[model samples]
Target: MESGKLLKAIIESAIDGIITIDNRGRVESLNPAALKLFGYKLEEVIGRNISVLMPEPDKSSHDGYLHRYQSTGEKRIIGKGREVRGLRKDGSTFPFRLAVSEVQYDDRVIYTGFIHDLSKEKEAEQRLKEYAAELEELVNERTKSLKKMLHALSEAKEEVSLSLLKEKELNQMKSRFVSMASHEFRTPLSSIQLSSVLIEKYAEPFDNPHIKKHVSKIKNAVGNLTTILNDFLSLERLEAGKVEPAFTPFDIVKLSEEVTEEMQMIAKEDQNIIYQHTGIESMVNLDQNLLRNCMINLISNATKYSGEHTFIEFNTEVTDTQCIVTIRDNGIGIPESDQKNLFQAFFRAHNTGNIPGTGLGLNIVQRYAGLMGGELHFESKINEGAIFTLSFKR
Candidate 1:
């Protein structure tokens, strides 16, 4: 191929745009890439000044810039590349990199320019900047939301603490009132009980059945009141931390027999308390008063709940390692639903219909057993039977 033809072919196929201008800044030649970059035909741009392809002040001032550089030999955009705008044939503008070179052939001087389109690169950079801004905004929003949630949780925790303190104060006030009322009522109730018994003895001369019956009713009523007051007193004392175990070596068998005898007198017609002892050792170190109270409470419950002719089994076994006492009854047993709350203060079984009770006996007994380093446990099913066991470690 000829050198000139080869040069022309290279200019036509070049990816970057190429343009040539004379010393007067008139367009001398434009490669195919340059023509496409300016959206102009080759023939149309041949004789025009290269400034026609520029926008705004650059279009008007480009001729003076070239003139000044030629005269003063000062370099601005002549040798080094610079970012500039190009105006298309449709009057739209775009960014490009423009590099100019001065060429001298004999006496003629020309400027050659190379252009690189910068549209895609600038668009991508803009998009990345937008994405970075959006990411920063999302992070800030999440952090603010988390801080609000933490503040709300802190307020809720403080409210819960205050409510708990108020509840504790109310419970203390209730305990004080219960203790005072129970203590004051016991004296008058005891007096009523003694007067009723003495009246029954002194009025025997009248021998009237009606007088005897009414006197007996007064005595029974007073007895029930006294029992209720005693339960209140015991509970108050326990809550006040005044009740402590006094351990001593004593005969558990004898204690069980005595409780059984006392409870039998109050049992229903034909009802009996059957007492039995196992294990050779009856002498165990325990809080005798607390143990006796537990026995009396269990036997009393059995006497009240069991029908006529039913027998309450009060069995005890003292071993070298432990002492076990179990009171079992075949009576209206505790309901499955009520059993969970059985040891709670003032809780009563639903099956106890019309029975006179303060509902504190079992709770008191359980507490007494705990003071004496013993455990109280029970098993029951509705209308089947119930067994209460007390165990003490030696």
Candidate 2:
């Protein structure tokens, strides 16, 4: 009696739902917690089967499970917690975590169950899951926006780089054009002035031959000026995309002769231009006007900077598909420090100090060479000489 009373007190005081069943699986006891967990009272469930608290199929087949356990001694729900449904007094059902334990007392077998309510825990777990989903969504959104911003930044940088490159190219072209125009214009202006002065001073006092010579000089100077202006206009046309290369068969030797003859008087007293043609005398397709200007610029430069009696050598060699021309001069050669800026506009060599020049000769020569599908190459040694080579494809 004392032991039964002690067990009753322990069952009623349990924090978890406590229930006990007899050896025949009948409900023997029900605790206060069990009453609250299942919405049943001791008077209602104590004499009924333990399956009264279960719903549906379990309520019908639980006796068989107990019979099998007794026969084989297998334990399924005993000493383990599992999720199951329970019945309430109102005929409604609620989910729970159920644990059952078996105890033996005085040849009687008893089962005790502890039940835990799951609604509150399930609600808490669902809330945590919802928070996690929201966090993942926020991270994906931020990542997408950051990636878009990075791509835009990359495109902006590329545009800035391209713009800067174009600006640099324009500046270089402007410098070259300005230098060539100044030099080319100055040459003709000087020639025209000198010729006019000679004609004015000597035409009345000198013989007919002298007057004729003066007039010829003025005409030649005017013609040269016209050529220079035409070359400048051609450059403008090329830059404006209006001029295309005219390829036609022509003799490079003939072009060299004409240029040297035109510049003969300008050559120093000690310097004379010599043209040597080597290899086959075959005609190559090229821009005649552009090639002529390139040769003229090179030859004129040689004449301008060379000593009084130095030899200005013009040599040409033709291969199967190309023609190479080299103009060499033994004069005050360019300094090493100024070699890099040779093709820059208005950048005259230090050696040409006080020399009458506009400093666009090399720049124009380089541009003309490029226009003719050729390249201009040079070599210079201070006080030794300079060699300029123009190579064109056949």
Question: TM-score, each model?
Answer: 0.56, 0.46
Candidate number achieving the greatest lDDT relative to the actual structure: 1
Pairs clashing within candidate 1: none
User: How many clashing pairs per prediction, in order?
Assistant: 0, 4
Best of the candidates, TM-score:
1
Q: Per-residue lDDT tens digits of candidate 1, residues 1-394?
A: 6998999999889999999999888898988888888889989989898889999899999988998979998654653489889999999998988888888866988888889988876675555445434433443453354345435433544454468775566456546545654655566556656665665675565465755666666566666766766787787789879998999999998888888888888788899889999998899999899899899988888878888989899999988899999999999999998998999876799878888886899999999999888899999887777999999999
Note the Cα lDDT for every prediction shown.
0.80, 0.71
Error of 2 at 227 (Å): 8.9
lDDT over C-alpha atoms for residue 371 of model 1: 88
Q: What lDDT is reached at residue 139 by model 1?
A: 34
Superposition TM-score, candidate 2 onto the true structure? 0.46
**Predicted structure 1, TM vs. truth:** 0.56
* Candidate 2 deviant stretches above 4 angstroms: 1-238
Q: Model 2, residue 275: what's the lDDT?
A: 84
